[model samples]
Target: MPSSVPSFAELLNQCERSAIHLELRDCYASTERFEAWKRGERIDWEDRESWWHPYDQLIAETVARGVSVRRARIVSEPVSEYIRWEHYVTHANVTAGEEVRWLPRRQATSISLPGNDFWLFDGALLRVHHFSGDGVVVEDEITADPETVKLCSAAFEAVWERALPHHLYTI
Candidate 1:
């Protein structure tokens, strides 16, 4: 992974057309949030006082500028509890104007996808994420390398073409 990159927020703010994310993991080891939810702390996304955050504000700002924000996740059919929690809370993302989708991992066997998750901004910059075995985010590499961007953009589109929209997806 490369260094000397701007913050994710800074890169997002620079986006002019689109921000597409490809999430290939079924579980993440950041267990704090998951444990809280597991303890039955319910979320009311409509209750902005409870679920809103600066990140939501950023997404709103980006979408307001007509820069489409989309996320596609490919998970195994019988997903992890974390993936189920993610599906439950996806309303927060949709509420902020970003589009979300889910694709079963079995459906992706034929596609050529990157090993790491990534965020492609405006089809120009690729923010590739590297995670440890336990799913901790170890590195975030930002690259303007045409090859990386092209590959990520193509992979995201391929997933998007087959993924089910959030509204239609079931845990």
Candidate 2:
């Protein structure tokens, strides 16, 4: 709704405001914090824990407030390791429910942007391109359109459809 790309925390806060759905290509950092919170452990600061703390609270609070949080993440190889970690930790805190969806990369779909407001992380580089209000606005990528947000939602659905049942994993 604001003319800006929502920060990860802002996005989770948005989720708290309404039913929230997210598509994660790789969620190592997020899953880690989720695991920590599930274990009731204070987040570690030396590592990349900031991105997840707010999200963890958002999920817990959302559930407490009777709002559901549904997530779909693309997992494979290294990413799968994080899934295993998150699965173990989350299960320890809460029983398996229909709230989270995990997808293997092979079954995941690639996302293409009409203009590059999108970011890509290949377990290596995190590439981000800027876009202007016009087509793919470069150098001054600031605002986002309702259509782009809709496209992001569609991308999440495409991946969610291919995700696996949580019980399938030992965690």
**Leading candidate by lDDT:** 1
Model 2 segments more than 4 A misplaced: 1-57, 77-80, 92-98, 110-144
- Note the Cα lDDT for every prediction shown: 0.90, 0.47
Backbone clashes for every candidate come to 0, 2
RMSD (CA, Å), candidate 1 to true, equals 1.8
**Counting only residues 3 or more apart in sequence or on different chains, how many pairs clash (N, Cα, C under 3 Å) in candidate 1?**
0
Clashes of 2: 2
Candidate topping TM-score? 1
Candidate 1 lDDT score at position 72: 98
Off by over 4 Å in 1: 1-3
lDDT of 2 at 162: 67
TM-scores, in order shown?
0.95, 0.49
